[model samples]
Target chain A: MSWFGNSEPEPPSGPSPMDLAKQEVDMYSDLFTKMSGLCFKKCVVKMHGESDLNVGEMSCVDRCVSKYMEAQEKVGVILKRAEESLAAQQGGVGGPAAGGVPGVPGR
Target chain B: MTPVQQQDFLQHLESQQRKDSLAMYNNLVFRCFDECSKSFRSKRLDDGETKCINVCAEKFIKLTSRVALRFQDIQQQKAKDEAAGVQR
Candidate 1:
């Protein structure tokens, strides 16, 4: 007896677009978390000796967080410029060209 | 396109986009980690190392973009020269 009638339908080939976007967001969040952890270790020089945290250490942590975010933004800008140039060279209307305009709102 | 075919195409596009984003993230992590981990003997980041890592990330991005743009300029110039030569 053949088992063909008992076979289940194949699962979707891949994740949906919304699922993909969520995954991308999660991946970026994870990356930022890792960077923050590293930055915290760097910025927090002295342990408070007790459970209480010191203002100096807290300030440093804040600076580190801002710096990390700035770095990410810088990298993003570089990538965006590269993509824009690449798109311009390729003569494609999409890619970076669609999103890359100077002094544009919501960019 | 049929509904099933459209869904399949969308799925494929989503997967590719995810893969590309992952690759970008990996590249970033690698670059940042390498810069940040230079003084990794103590398993903690030093003040100097932190500063270095921050500067490194910024400079790396700048350098990458500059090189890419320079290469593109050269290619464009070469193409222009070739066209001029052909005209001559």
Candidate 2:
């Protein structure tokens, strides 16, 4: 799917583009599993009188997923800001102090 | 980026992704079982239990896709920035 912003249509050297695509799918699948699991824990109550999720629970989960992802982005921004400041303090742009942060979903 | 560094990052992502998928699997099974399995009178799932589990799975899948789309949008933005040579 032209992942990683690699717009060049380069021929395969080692790993095929299919391999990279699989990795990309794996990344998103894991993200979905982890994020939804967490949001379920947060939004769903242990006690349920009916088999179906109530309207409130459903809406809460909907909001929870969006907010959870947004929180990640917001935290990413703060993390970037902190890293940038640390880099400036170290007298360089994105010096060693600015790295080591893990990639978010899809990098 | 160098091949070694690229490999390291990909390994990191793979390991973390595996861990997250496993954790979610265990959590999903445990919680759904706990919530849906109420009676021990039979070895089979009752109607209510089956229905509850179905609903639970359906809801979980729904939530996952919803978050996935949101996540895709964010990642697409990041991809565009990276494509523009804005290194993160």
Candidate 3:
């Protein structure tokens, strides 16, 4: 959609899907870095030495990161399913009601 | 307004739209945090705690869908009831 009455920008010339996926991963990693930092600090109360975390502490951080990723994936799946079911209920096979066609069951 | 003034106004509007999109993203993150970090009892998350967060997210979306459907059902039923009443 055009914003502020500006014309739509041209599509990127380079690898679009890869670029988009990389961008998404970067955003998620930024979020994960913040969350994992907090969790790591809490779990790794005492560092063995400079730049050293014990096995338990390291494991905790690993698990925390994994869990965060899993949570993100789960949220994505949940939203996708909700959209699909709502679409079905609205008379589309697996998404929101399509445009056009009267008395097609979608309001 | 002059052409330059119009251009500036459009740029400002675009910036505001970007801010709004960022705010929407932040709100989603906050929602996820609420579902994931409900309790801070221990420094380390228990075995099932992470799983709970995933489950919570899934259930929350499902609940949202159900609520929406229920609302639509109620509206349909109400309309049907009103039509019957009118027919009577």
Best by TM-score: 2
Worst 10 residues of 3 chain A by lDDT: A1-10
Give per-model TM-scores: 0.38, 0.52, 0.32
Supply candidate 3's per-residue lDDT for A55: 68
Encode model 3's per-residue lDDT on A36-99: one tens digit a residue.
Answer: 4445334444312333444665556556555554565566566666777777788875343222
lDDT of 2 by residue, B1-88 (tens): 4686678657866786788767766776787887789999999999888877777766665566666666667667667776676454
Residues B2-78, candidate 1: write the lDDT tens digits.
Answer: 69756765685577657755664566567666646655479788876666656655543433333334334543554
| Candidate 2: residue pairs that collide | none
Q: Model 3, B26-83: lDDT tens per residue?
A: 6445654554564678887665656654554443343333333433454365456555
Give the winner by DockQ: 2
Q: Which regions of candidate 3 deviate over 4 angstroms? A: A1-19, A46-51, A89-107, B1-88
Regions more than 4 Å wrong, model 1: A1-17, A93-106, B1-88
- The digit string of per-residue lDDT tens for model 2 on A1-107 reads 22555533435554444455446556556656767778777777644345356688777776776676677667867777777688789888546321123244323
DockQ values for all predictions? 0.03, 0.21, 0.02
What stretches of model 2 exceed 4 Å from their correct place? A1-3, A6-30, A44-62, A74-99, A103-107, B1-27, B81-88
Could you tell me the interface RMSD of model 3?
Answer: 18.3
